[model samples]
Target: MVLGRQRRQIMKILIAIDSFKGSLSSKEAGEAIKSGILRVIPDAEVLISPLADGGEGTVETLVEALGGSLETVRVKGPLFQEAEAHYGILSDSQYSPKDEKLAVMEMSQASGITLVSPEERNPLKTGSYGVGEMILDAYHKGCRRFLIGIGGSATNDGGIGMLSALGFRFSKENGEEISPIGEGLKDLAGIENASVPEGLLQCSFQIACDVENPLYGENGASLIYGFQKGGNKELLSQMDLWMKHYSELVKEYNPAANPEAPGSGAAGGLGFAFRSFLQGELKSGVSLILEETKLSKKMQGADLVITGEGRLDEQSAMGKAPIGVAKLAKTQGIPVIAFAGTVTEGAKACNQAGIDAYFPILREITTLEDAMNKETAKQNLADTVEQAIRLYRLQHKKQ
Candidate 1:
C-alpha cells in the first residue's frame, strides 16, 4: 500500500491591529503576527494594515496605511511657545475627490496637555494657536479636506486661539484684540472675519470627537475637563461663566450655533469652534478611520481577520478600535480573532461583539515595564499568534 501526503492549503489573513501603546506600533505588531503566521504556514498570504482610533497614533497609522507623507511645522504651543507639529498628507487620491487632498492631524501634536508640564498645566493660560497653525500649514499645501483628532487638548479657550490664527479676530468693546487664551473669553465682545482667507470657504473639516458635554454649565467643558487641565474650584467657576458668555457671543455671530449640542464641549470647546465657525462635522473616530482606510472593501476576499489593541477591557467592548474591526468583519460573515497584551474580565464582551476568539499575549509572569518593552512584546505576540494559528489549522483539518 502507498500513502500519499496531503498538501497544505494557503491561507490569506488580514490584520488591522491598533498600536500597542507604549509597546508596539500598529505596523510592528502586524509584522510580528505575520511572522508567526508564516512560521506555521510558509505559503500563507498575509496583509498588514495600520490602525488607530483617531487618537495619539491616528496620524501615523493613516499615513502609513495610505502611502502618505508627514510634514512638520514650527507652531505655537499651548503656552504660546514654539513647538514642532506634524500632520500627514494622504497620497492616495481614492480617499478624496479629484484635485483634493486629505490631511490627518492630531491636535495633541500642537496643543496637547502632555506638551505642558504639571506645573504649567493652566487651562486659563493655554491656547490652541498651534492647532490653527497646523491647519493653515496643511491648507497651504493644497489640502482641502481635514480629518482632525481633537483629543488631549490643554486649552479651554473655546478655540478662539485657533480661529484667531485663521484670521478670525476676537476683540473687546474698545476694538483691541483679546489675548486669545482662556482668559480672552472674558473680554470677547465681537468677532471679525474680514481677514479670514478666501480659500477657507472651500475647505472641509471632520473632527474626531467622542464627548457629549455642552459648551457651558455643570456638564460643560470648563467644569467637566478643566480640572484635569489645571483648573481650581474658583478658576473653574470663573471659566464656566466665561464659557457661557462666549457661547452667547458665538450664537450672535451664527444663530445656528448650538452650544448645547453633543460634543460642543469637546477639546475645550474646540468642537463648537469647528462646528459653528468652520462648519465641520463631528464624527466617531473609529467610523471615520474605517471608512477612510476602506477596510471593509479590503476584507472581502480574506479568509481570516485579526485585530487588537494594547489592552482589552470594558472600554474595548464599547466600540473601540478592535471592536470596530470585529464588527466590520462580522458584516461580511468572516471569522475574527483578537490578541492583546492583557485581557480583563470585561473583554469577554468582545466575544459577543463579533470576535470569535481572543488571546492574551503574555506567556509568563512579568512586570508591566518588562512586558511593554518593544522587543519582548514583539516576541510574545509572535509566539501567541503561532499557537493560535496551530489551533486554527487543527480545527480545519478536523473539518
Candidate 2:
C-alpha cells in the first residue's frame, strides 16, 4: 500500500449542497462547505458545486454548475399583475450539436407563495398561471425540455392557469368562464374547451417532487396544505369540494384516470394538472439533480462528505437533499456526516439512510436568521468539526 508515500498529493474535497433559505443561496452553501473543509484540511484541493433538489433554487443551482447566465421574464405573479421572475438557460451540453438549449426554472420563483404579502394571501385568487407564462416564453425560445421545481406554491387552483396558458380552457354552465383560481373553480360547472397546444406535449417535463398526496378529497392538497396558503376553515372546505368537482369533471372526459392518483396533489394540485392534463411524468427531484450533476462520480474519491439541510428528522430521511447525498456517499463506503439547523424527534430515522451521524449546529433555541450571523455560526461549526475530527482520530488510532 502506498498510504505512507502520499505527501504533496492533493486530497480532493467536493462541496455540494442546497440553499439554506433566507440565509444563503446554493452557491453560498458551497462556499460554506468549502470553508468547513479548509478549516480541517487546509492542504486539500476544493471543488465547489452548489446542488439543488429541483425546488426553490433550481435555476440558480443549474446556472452555477453549467457556468451559464441568468435570464428574467415578466410573468403573472401569485397576485394579479405581472412580475419579473428568474430562470437560467444553460449553454448547450458539450455533446449536443444544437445551438439552443434547455432552460431550468424553479417555478416557485414566479408562482411561489413568497410573492404574496400577509395582507393579500387569498388562495382563491392565486394560481400557477405565472409559471405557465414563463414556460411559454421559454418554449418560444426553442427550449425542448424544462427542469421545473414545484415547491412552495401560492395557489391550490389545480394548475388551471398553467393549462390556460397552453390553450386549455375551463368553463361554466352560463356559457362564459373566468380564470382558474379557487373562486373560479367553484364556478367551474364544466370544462368546455381544451385546445392543448400542438406539439406542446412533445416537450418533456422533469417535475422535482416526491410527495405523493392525491389531488382531491381528504389527504389531498386543500385539506392538507391549503391553510398554510391562507385557506380559512370555510375556504378549506370549499376548495376541497371544488377540487373534487373538478376531478369528477375531468375524469368524465379522460376516463382512464381521476384525481386520487398518487402525487396528484403535489405543489397545490399542480401535479395533477401536469400529470393528467399535460401527460407529464413525476420523479424524485433530488435524485434527478444528483444524476444530472454526476454527484455520485464526485463523491467517489472523497475521504469524507458533509451535507445538511434546514432540518434533519424523519422527513429528511424521506428523499431530502442531505440524505440523497449521504446515500450516494455510503454506496462508495465513504463516511457521511450531516449538520443541520435542528434535529427533530427520532433522529434515529436517518441511520438506515446512510447518515453516519447528525450534528445540530444550534445548541439552544434560537432564530436561525439571527444565529446565522456568519462569523459566529462559522466558528461554532468549525469548532464542532475540530472536536469531532479529534475524536475520530483517537478512536481510529486505538482500533
**Best candidate according to TM-score:** 1
**Candidate 1, superposed: residue stretches over 4 Å from native:** 1-10, 397-399
Clashing pairs in 2: none
Q: What is the C-alpha lDDT profile of model 2 across 1-399, one tens digit per residue?
A: 376557435566566666666555666656765666666667777776557778777777778766867888988888767789998876556412255466788878878888998778888889888888888888787777777778888889888887777777788888586676767888886664457666677887777777889997779999888988888888888889888888888887567555877888988889888877766777888887887677888776776677776667898887788788888887888787776666798777887888888777765667766667665555555566556655654664576
In candidate 2, how many Å is residue 304 off? 2.8
Single out the weakest 10-residue window by summed lDDT for candidate 2: 91-100
lDDT, model 1, position 2: 28
Model 1 clash pairs?
A: none
Model 1 per-residue lDDT tens digits across residues 1-399: 122222225577899999999889999999999999999988888988778988898998888767899899999999999999999998577788785899999999999999999999998899999999999999999899999999999999999999999999999999999998999999999987998889985798988887889999999999999999999989999999999999898999999999999999999999999999999999889888988888898898788999999998888998899989999999998899999999999999999888899999999999999999999999999999999999998887798
The segments of candidate 2 whose C-alpha lies over 4 angstroms from its true place after superposition are: 1-12, 35-45, 92-100, 189-196, 233-235, 252-256, 310-315, 340-349, 359-371, 375-399
RMSD of each: 3.5, 4.1
